[model samples]
Target: MVSLDLRRLRFLREFEERGTLGAVATALGYSPSTVSQQLALLEKDVGARLFEKAGRGLRLNDAGHLLAQHARVLLSAAEAAEADLAALGGDIRGTVRAGGLQSAARRLLVPAVARMMAEHPRVRVEVFELELEQALPGLRLGAVDLVIGDEYDGHPRPRPAGLRFTAALEEPIKVVLPAAHPLAGAGRPVPIARLRSDIWTASAEGTGHHAMVVGTCRALGGYEPDLRHRSNDADVQLELVRVGAAVALMPPLALPADDPAIAVRDLAEAALRRRLVTVTRETPPAPALTAFLRAVTDQARNS
Candidate 1:
């Protein structure tokens, strides 16, 4: 095996994405001939065929793909090394953008943001409300710096290429009911089966959360309760419960206050616990992100 360069692997990726060397040169501000020369040097140095011609396009062979994967890791490490060097100086200033699902923003991120602001005054953080899948792609495309997401509704898989994540917390789903409701005041732990008659004010149809709730109810010998209304907002769901419109499923973390209006009933099995994670394409997270995740993780622990 010959000595390979990160620059060459980067070129191959750009070539694959761009589909032409001339376009890669134009985008990279290098002449076409210089791009070709660098690639030739790279190929000779590596001693493996990096790409093959397919009509007017170039595609990576198996070895080239594997090398590209490793190249990404090396380039990321190099970038982090540079950032670490820069951070040794007095001033550490940059923006970290993040996105998460609506529930996380309401129950987790808002407090996390407050703590982050108090601790890291110099760093600006902007958090957006988005679904997990929506946030994951942005983390990959470099559109957002971090994503707070969940894995529930029975999804368990390897992380996508070029991204990393930290497990923040595992929150269980609770059954919410009006305080004066039939099962709320019952002494010896109200049976989960009794929940079927309650009109459930749930999230919209076809979402993972909704599916999970429905699946759990069915599994535990409960009738899929009447879904009178659908909403993603915890506050609104609480209001519906207060008005006796319906009951709602809530995470234990987002349990409503002991209002005469609502009671949170913890479920039976651990299978309903939703795992929340913070993700980034950055090999090493920005300082702001680290601090924020730490605070939220601590909060999650306490909760």
Candidate 2:
């Protein structure tokens, strides 16, 4: 009788989700040739052809699909079993693979990780900086165990099945300007229309923040912004504002404490805010993950 290898099944499932052996290898920290060799060995062990050539690439055959479906269940069960064992041991110890946007990584995740390291010395965490769009699919594909993301008031992300979301923080989005700018010392909330003529800096197109900036300007000012600079880096945006090159809309969480060269003001609309959320699979979380999540929430509250 032939036995199935869980590691190979994991590779197969990753291949199914990623649509390429190279992607699977990258996610799993293996070489492409190793991934191909392992899959070929799996096919031999199962006595079936698992993949077939399609144009310039390879795709899973019917047998591969069926096995991959079972692999999902088996892999989930394996995780469940590990969780059970960890619970029995009564010690929060394990490695957690997590990912998040750059702002969250700096503001919330980094501090939380520090606290976790001080408290649970045995728990390990690996973090990746990923865009919100990429992070969600990474969760589904098992490339990341947890993810942190943002949701604006008007733009809601699509929540895929078999996942959980926990709200960590909610803060208003503010307009940022150089300290020497005319509007910096304005005693009242800054109206969107007031900055219509000023050059702007924002995240690149296709990002949620860019859409928010454009949509808000169109709704309030009746004109599109002259976006002169584009970057996803919060510090870079703030720097642009500090140098009087451009103004931008930014969240409070992304700001540094008491910067002398920059000023932040509330939007006149008062309804533009974003929620920071932590996402994980629906399965019972390990103790380390539970602890890490708690730490992240605490950090957000304190920040």
Candidate 3:
């Protein structure tokens, strides 16, 4: 009878999902050499070649793919067993790792952590600020027990198998401008066509927010924006707007608490909004994670 190591099986599953040794290492918090060695050992144990060179990168061969399909079931069963044990323990006393985008972390996750600390003192919550690209992969690899993710209008993200998502909030995206700007006090939804001549600041290209801004502008104004600055930091974008350097499209949660120099207005032509969600694996979540999710949901609803 052959015995397979669950840890190495997990590594293979992560590699199959992530498609690279470096990504697997980052997701599992292991060195690249270690991931490679473990997978090699797994191949030795199974008496088959699992990986093959694909140009400069490595990809799983047919045998590896077949093994990985089985590995998913085994890993999920292992997780289910662990969850059962946690349920039997009857205490939310374990660590729950979570990740989210910047604005969500500040507005949603921080409050959730406070609630978790106060209500479930024994549970430890570890938080990481990660964009959707990194967060989703981390969630699939079991590095993150929960992820706060966003989906913009007209930019739906594909949901991978073995994960569950629950909607937290849906808030409009507003056009942020300098307080002294001419249209700052419009007191109504500002049309994007009116801002065509204005210099724009947006998230870096290829990001979901950036795509939404570009798409909304092109649809409403009939021309591409004069994008002068690009950044992922909402605070930096708001600062640029405050200094009269550029105008930006931003979600409400990204706004500073009391920035008198920034004015936010909804877009009349295209009302852009993003849906925030909490993501977890399909298996029964740990008690601490479930508690954290409840806290986050409550905070999001009240906010």
lDDT of each: 0.70, 0.86, 0.88
lDDT of 3 by residue, 1-303 (tens): 557999888889889888999988886678999999999999999988998999988999999999999998998888888888888999778899988888999889999999998999999999888877777766776778999888898999888899998899999989888999889895677889999999999888877888888898898889999998998788889889989999998888898766789888888887788999898999998788889999999999998
Question: How far is 120's C-alpha from truth in model 3 (Å)?
Answer: 1.0
Top candidate on TM-score is: 3
Candidate 2 displacement at residue 177 in angstroms: 1.2
lDDT of 2 by residue, 45-131 (tens): 899999999888799999999999999898788778888899899989998888888889988888888998999989998988886
lDDT of 1 at 180: 84
Better of 2 and 3 by TM-score: 3
* lDDT score at residue 77, model 3, on the 0-100 scale: 88
Better of 1 and 2 by TM-score: 2
What TM-score goes with each of the models? 0.68, 0.87, 0.91
From the highest lDDT down, the ranking of the candidates is 3, 2, 1
**Model 2, stretches more than 4 Å misplaced?**
14-41, 53-57
Output the lDDT of residue 190, model 1.
Answer: 48
- The parts of candidate 1 lying over 4 Å away from their true place are 1-82, 152-158, 222-225, 268-271
